[model samples]
Target: MSDDQLFALANALPLVGWLALCLAPLARPALVASARVVAAAMAVGYAVMVGLALARAGGPAPDLTTLSGLARAFSDPHVMLVGWVHYLALDLWTGAWEAEDAGRRGVPHWLLLPCLALTFLAGPIGLLLFLGVRTLPGRRVPARP
Candidate 1:
């Protein structure tokens, strides 16, 4: 498939997981499992794209060390797609964890919905919101094994 088509697929893959997270609190296990599957699929795509980027002829190897080097590396659409998929996979994975963790901790599902939405849109910010919610008095529950 073309990179643009792959990009569209990658973007769409996590929406179901996110929607389930927000709307299906009772099906936490299934939701989490589905999120894992989606993230894994995205991760496989990411790995293949990375390998392709590395193997492509006549381009400087992707540089993650310096800001300018990183910018230059991401100038390639393939590398950008890899980065986008990385974010999609990890953010959706994080939202799944947040949903599971919040459910375990007895945090209200209503409270978690915003956090999940934030995580879907802006990963760390949503995590930060969830972490803050976890600190409220009486929100604590023993960590999962």
Candidate 2:
């Protein structure tokens, strides 16, 4: 597939998990499991794209050791797509974890919706928001023995 096609696929795959998390609170376990599967699939795609990017670098490979080097590496479209897929995979995985954790902690599903939306749009910010939300009074559930 063309890199652009692959990028589109990578972007689309995570939405299934996100939709399940947002729409099906009662199916947390299944949704989380499926999200992990989606993330794993993206990771495999990332590895393949990275390998292709490296192989296609006929001249000096993009250096990854410094900030400037990393920027230069990302200048290559293939490398940039690989990086984006990496972000999509990890962000979806993190969202899955957040959903499961929030469900376990007794946080209201309504409260979690915004956090999930934030996470879908901006990964760490959504996580930070969820973390803060979990700490609110009356949200905590006692640990099970």
Candidate 3:
């Protein structure tokens, strides 16, 4: 397949895992079934995307010491797609952690679902939103006298 097609495929792979995560333990009983999805995606999907990116000429030779340098490094379509998948893996991992932490803290499904969805869509925004939600005061346990 052409690099454009490969890029499209790379983008689609994470959506499947993110959708699976939407049915996370916090929201349903099928959580266990999808638990492996993100990790597997990270392992397989990331490798494939990175490999494709490296296939391009000079794709990995950028200085990468500054923002523009990083941008130039990823100017190649394949490398750009690899960069996207890199975000996907990091975002999904963070979303997974957020789900587990929210579950432990008794955050409601109504809230968690949106947060997870947002995280899947925009990595930093969702994490920031969830962190804000986490600041809501919870019932305090009494101290022993």
Q: Which candidate leads in TM-score?
A: 1
Question: What residue runs in model 1 are displaced by over 4 Å at the alpha carbon?
Answer: 140-145
Error of 3 at 66 (Å): 2.4
Report the alpha-carbon TM-score of model 2 versus the true structure.
0.91
Q: Could you give candidate 1's per-residue lDDT for residues 23-74 as a string of tens digits? A: 6477888878888788888888889888887777476555779999999888
User: How many angstroms is residue 16 displaced in model 1 relative to the true structure, after the best TM-score fit?
Assistant: 1.3
Cα TM-score of candidate 1? 0.91
Ranking by lDDT: 2, 1, 3
Residue clash pairs of candidate 2: none
Error of 1 at 60 (Å): 3.2
Question: Residue 61 in model 3: shift from native, Å?
Answer: 2.0
- Per-residue alpha-carbon lDDT of model 2 for 1-145, expressed as tens digits? 9878988898899998888888647788897888888888888988888787777768986678999999988887778889999999888888888888888898899999999899989999999999999999987787889
Q: Estimate each model's TM-score.
A: 0.91, 0.91, 0.75
lDDT of 2: 0.87
Worst 10 residues of 3 by lDDT: 26-35
Q: Model 3, 1-145: lDDT tens per residue?
A: 8768866776776666666666666454355235447556666877976665567455347778999988877786666776776777788777777776666666765787778878878878899888887667882334546
Q: How high is the CA lDDT of each candidate model? A: 0.86, 0.87, 0.69
Best by lDDT: 2
